[model samples]
Structures are given as structure tokens and as C-alpha cells.
Target: MRNINEGENESKRSPQSIVREVIQGGQSVMSADARADARFVESESVIAENILSILCVPLIIKERIAGAIYVDHRQARHLFSQKDLNFLEAFADQAAIAIENARLYEELEEARTRLSLENESLRREVLVEKHLDSVVGQSEAVAKIQFSIRKAASGNSTVLLRGESGSGKGLVARIIHNVSPRRNGPFIKFNCAALPETLAESELFGHEKGAFTGADRRKLGRFELANNGTIFLDEIGKVTLAIQAKLLRVVEDKEFERVGGTQTIKTDVKIIAATNLDIERAIDQGTFREDLYYRLNIIPLVMPPLRDRKDDIPLLAEHFIRKICRDLGIETKHLEPGVLDLFVRYNWPGNIRELEATLHRAIVMSNGDTITRNDFYGLFGDIVPASPDAGPVPMPGSLLNPVIGKMDITSDIYDEVMSSVDRQLIERALESSGGRIREAARRLGLAR
Candidate 1:
């Protein structure tokens, strides 16, 4: 129970000489009466701290002595016996095991951290690859869009993408972000049409706690989150004038206050906006701000409708087939010859999205190894194929045309319109075929 007040000075006072010897030799050393021993009696530690009885034992780790433990009695002679030395050796062995276990645990933790970082890097790489691959075309129209994307990526100018819904406008935006200098920063997207006017403001500019009724906590807005990066505003035409004014500030000055907060937050973000609406028409109608349009239209990029790039239909269809099949955990399916020809002939008013949906339906409805032209019947409902007599092909129209008004029509409207047309055509064919569906299908150039 003797305490060593000068243990801190032992390393500096030449006690390391004896301790190092014991550690190197992997053995114990004892001086039952140090004053009676000439070896350490003259040492500064032994003389200054008063003569002592000492015991030292080596601390071995993995068959090598890393260090040693030394115990001494300040006032007693022969206080430590052979039994005490044996007990200290057993404690040293336990201490070595504890140290080794701690070292191993730290190494394991370091390895785990490295693995986690590697996995995250790999995941981001895969996402970028998947996004790039999904672009899926080599047509002139596609090549032109790719060229514009590359040009846009070279700068941080505000880009306004004008395209029909489902024409992969968002994908183009992401390509710009991934290739730009701000690629390492966050790419935040918010659909202006997804939230109500009240909530849209809160979402775009964030809100302070108690900003309004049911506003329980403060929130960070998309602009704030996308600082030093890119923020994609989908359906930007849907925002109200109030929100437009606030958004214009961000586009022009890169600063805005939260919904109810007085603090002005500055952001360094690139704006990439997409809208199916015609900015010209909207500006004329006073629904959209002219100044805002000018600021966002710095680089206007139009995404071509799928119908214009009919040559890419086969490539896109096959890509979607493989991707959707893999996602559904089903065997890969092929398209029958002439099916792709029919796809090319049909003016996919819904653009790329409609084509993908059509293919998804064909794959889901058909159990065969190949999707034939007949599979489109359950989806497109007797829409006539490539025939000289069926009817003239539906031309791709603009969203500003009052008759078309909106370019992005839903699947339900598409189905309803096609069904009505199909019903009239079927009635005429039935009259010509004595009310036989088989014969009607034949007259309409549809698959039976």
C-alpha cells in the first residue's frame, strides 16, 4: 500500500536503464534491499527518493516485451517476496492482453470507416453512370441536345429547358450539374407544381418557426440547401407572382429571406428550370414575369419530342425493356420484328415518357419472350399501325397552340381520346365486316 509520489520523475531520473534491461531481457529483477546493493544505490532516483526495496517485471506482447512494471517499498526491506513477484507477472500478462485488444479494436474501427467511405463513393459513381446511360439515344436530335448540355455545363448561367413533360428535362438538368464545376455541391430539386402557393413559398425559401399556422419548426429551403450547387425548379410556370418575385431575387442577387424570418441568407447556386408552358404566352398573359423569364432564358435549351427522333425508338425501347425487366426481377424480353417499326410510325404525343409507359405495359401484359405488335392493343387500344390507309399520322404539336394548349397530357386523356377514336373506327369497320372484331382489326391494320 506504499505510494510513490515521485513516479512521474522515475523516467527522467535514470530508472529507465534498469526497466529497459528487464524489458529487453524478458525477465524480472529484484533488489530486496537496494541500499545494500551497489548496482542502484548510487543512482539519483534511489539516493534522492530514499533507498527502497524494488521488484520489476517485463510486459510482453505477442512474444515481445513492450515495456515493464516496477514496484518498490519506500520504508520496508524485503517487503516483496517471490509470491509477490509471481502475482505482478500475472497482472502484467493481463495488462498486455488488454492493450493488444484496444489496439486491435482501434484498427478494426479505422478499417470500417475506410470501407464506409469507399461504399459511398461507389454508390455516387453508380448513380452518375445510370443517369448518363438513361439518356439512351444517338440520333441527331439527341446529339444536339447533348451538345447543348455540354455547353451548359461549361458555365454557371441560368438555363431554361423548354420541353414536353417526360422528355427527360430533369435528366438534362442533372447532366449539367454532374459535369459542371459545382458537381461536388448538392443538386436540389423542387417541383413548383407539387405544393400549394402557401407551402411552395415555404419550400423554396424555407420558413422560420411560427411562420404561419401549423409551422412548428424552422426549415431550410431548397435554395439554401443547394448553395454553391444547382437547384432544379421543375414546372416553374406553376409558381404564383409573389413566389416569382422572390425567385427573381435569388436568380438576380443570390439572396433571399426565409418565409417569416428577417435574416437575409445568401446562396451561390446555379438555376436550371424546366416548364412545359410557353414562356412567351405566359408573359403575354401576365401570368409569368417578363424580367424573370429574361433572367432564366440566358440559355434556352429545347428537348425534342420523341416523335422527331423516331430513329432512337428501338434503342430506347430495348434499354427500357432491360432496365424494367431487371427491376421487376424477370427474364429479359425481346421485341418482335415490325413492333419497333410500329413504334416509330406512331407519333408518341407523350414523348419519351409515353414510350416508356407503353413498353412497360407491353412487358407487364405479355407473358411471351417477345413483345409483339399485338401487345400494344391492351395499351394503345386499336391505334392503327403504319398503313397507307389507316389515317394520317398525328403530328407533334406545340403547347402554346390553343387547340392543344397543354403539351403534357395525362395517360388518362390519351387513353380516352384514343378509345373514342377507336370506337368510331371499330363501328365503321364492324359495319364493313358484319360486326366481326377480327375483321375490324384487319380493316384498321391492327393486330388481332
Candidate 2:
């Protein structure tokens, strides 16, 4: 029963009321006539509300009184009984359980959210480390390139990577995107040279259903897939003039329509274009548009050739050796004494790519744990000459003159002459170095 004067009743039923007594005593209180009961007769709320009957029971959970349930009736005395109090107490027990369960569920949800955020942070850390490790080098050129990568990642401007083939331009492009603000977004890569001219436009901008002869379904383009992220266009210099014009509109306006579609799709993608071909020369020949070149050249990064950074050869070799060995499921191998010296002296025409391929071949051909100089013999075409003290080695052309027309017709003359020259050269170096193999390799300019 509710009090007619609730505010005044609350003030009157403080420390010495029926509900308060049940809570403190942890027991039930049933009054047949609350207005005349000795315990509530002096209470102002009981007399003012003319309460005839009252029942109050403490809600107990684990021997603790959480609260009290109070019921009363003014029209009739002895309205509530022991049976009603018993039912309410049982219901309070289930209510308390439900309250505790709801609290636990909230905590579990909070913990799940926290753990998900931490996992995402850890994933980004591992991704950055993997990309940085791929750019293996210790030269000043490499240091400069790393600095440029950081600068390029700081903004949303288009980037142009210029270098020869196999010089790690693609690797650099990925690193830039991984460390940028768009790191959490998608990174889409496209090779312009891989697609034929007839299909280049549709491949780049996608096509609507039935747009062409075999276009059966609608397709999403790389730029659409790379929205709010990055798109790396490899061999951008090879794109034809017709595609270049469409590419210019996307770069400048960030909008394009799919092939044979009227709706213009917009994208917020960062463009990173790379090419081994000289773009300036392509523009001179009217093959590549100059405006598109200028748009992509906002942040240019040049990857140095492996030949120019010779000091990094040993490091690159060690990296590729360990990587290739692990990939092939073989025991780790080390390069022999003279192998690094041989690498430093020769010119790598294919840059870092050739070095890696050569090492892979050497490791596969080698039968032991150590990769010897012989494993790399004839891999770099002609051999380097001996040290200055060992005297000049004859050229293959000059050596062929003395044995001309003297061999049998059935003999492999070229192989026989070159083998003879190699044998003599090794013999002379061995004699000059007092028969010490290590010293002989040094005198032959094959060892440090």
C-alpha cells in the first residue's frame, strides 16, 4: 500500500519502522492491525495512512539482507499471511541471481572489446616488421630510401617509384603503404604490363554485366577495392595512351565510370606507381601523358641499383641464403671464403634479383653446408683476372688464336680451349702463392 503523503511518510518511517525492523533483524514481520501494533503504534506513517494490516520480509542472499519487501492494506486487517511472504522471498532469490548474471555479462563484453583492440595493434606491429625486413641493405642509399619512405607515408599524395627491374621497387612501395595512415585499409597491386592492350581498360576500371562479348557479370576495379587505402600500379610506363587518359581523370578528379556503365564511381585511394622503364623517354615519344606523369611524381622515390651499392652484397647474400634455405627445408649453409669477394667484383646486370637467383642456384647445386667459389663458376660469364702481382690473364679471343685450326673436327674446341686456359691460370696462381690454397685464391683476386 502506498502512503497518501509519500514525502512525509518517508521522513516519519526512518530508523524504527516495520520494513527497517525486518531488514535489520533478517526476519519477517506480520501485523494484523498495524495502526494498533505496539511496534508501529507510535509511528506517524502507520497512523496517518490508517494501515490495518502489514507484512514485511527481508530478502536474504547468502545470509546477507539485501533489502526488504513491504506490503500493507488499509481496508482490511490481517490481509497478508506467511504464505505470501514466503512466495516473495523465493522470487527475490531468483531476481538477485539475474542481477549478478547481467553484471558478469557486461564484464565479459568489456574484456572481449579490449582484447580485440590489443590483437589489432599486435598485428600491425608484426606487419611493419616483416615489410622492413624485406628491404635488406646497410648502404647510405638504403638509409636514404628508408627516410623517403617515411616521408611519403606521412601524406596522401601520389608516389612514383623509379628504378631498374629487380631493384626492390615493389618492396618499397608496399612498405610505404604499410606504414601510412591507410595501413589498416586494403593494399591493391596491379601490373600494367601483365594485361594486354585490348583488355587493359576493362581490367583497370572494371566492367558492367554484358559490357563486352564475354563480360557476363559486373566487376569491381582495383581502385574501388582500394577505397580509403592504396593501389600500387606496377609498370605504369607501359600503359597505353588511351588508358593513360582515363587514369589521369581518376588521379585528378578521383572519379571514374566502369566500362559501359553510366554511373560514375568515386574513390578515395592513394596511388603509388612504379616503373623500370624511363617515363621521361616515354613521354618524349608521346606514349605517356606528361600531365599524368606530373600528378604521380608528387613524391618520387628512387631505388638504387645493386651494383651501385656493392657494400650491401654480403648482407643481401646472407639474408637470401637463410631465407632460401628455410623455404627449401634444408640445413642452413654459409658462403665459402672467396664467394663474397667474387660477388663484390662482378657487375650485377639484373640488380638484386640476379644476386638472389644466383644464390638460389648455387645452394641447390651445392652438396655440402659450405657454398664454394666453384659452385658459382661460369655463373657470371667470364672469370675475373688474378691479382696485379700474378700478371695479366689473356683474353678468351687472344687465347683462341694460338690453337686455331689445330684441333680435330670432332672435338669441342671452344670448351677444350677455355678449360685449358682456366687450368693454366690456376696453376700459375698456385705456384706464385707457394701452393697455399687460401693464398692462391687471394692472389687470383677471388678472396679478400
Candidate 2: regions farther than 4 A off: 1-129, 386-448
Q: Model 1, range 118-170, lDDT digits (tens) per residue?
A: 35434544523424445788898888887888888888899999999889897
Native-to-model Cα distance after best TM-score fit, residue 305 in candidate 1, in Å:
0.6
Off by over 4 Å in 1: 1-133, 378-448
lDDT of 2: 0.80
Number of the top-ranking candidate, with lDDT as the measure: 1
Name the best candidate (by TM-score).
Answer: 2
lDDT of 2 by residue, 190-222 (tens): 789998876878767877778989976566677
Estimated TM-score for each candidate: 0.58, 0.60
Clashing pairs in 1: none
TM-score of 1: 0.58
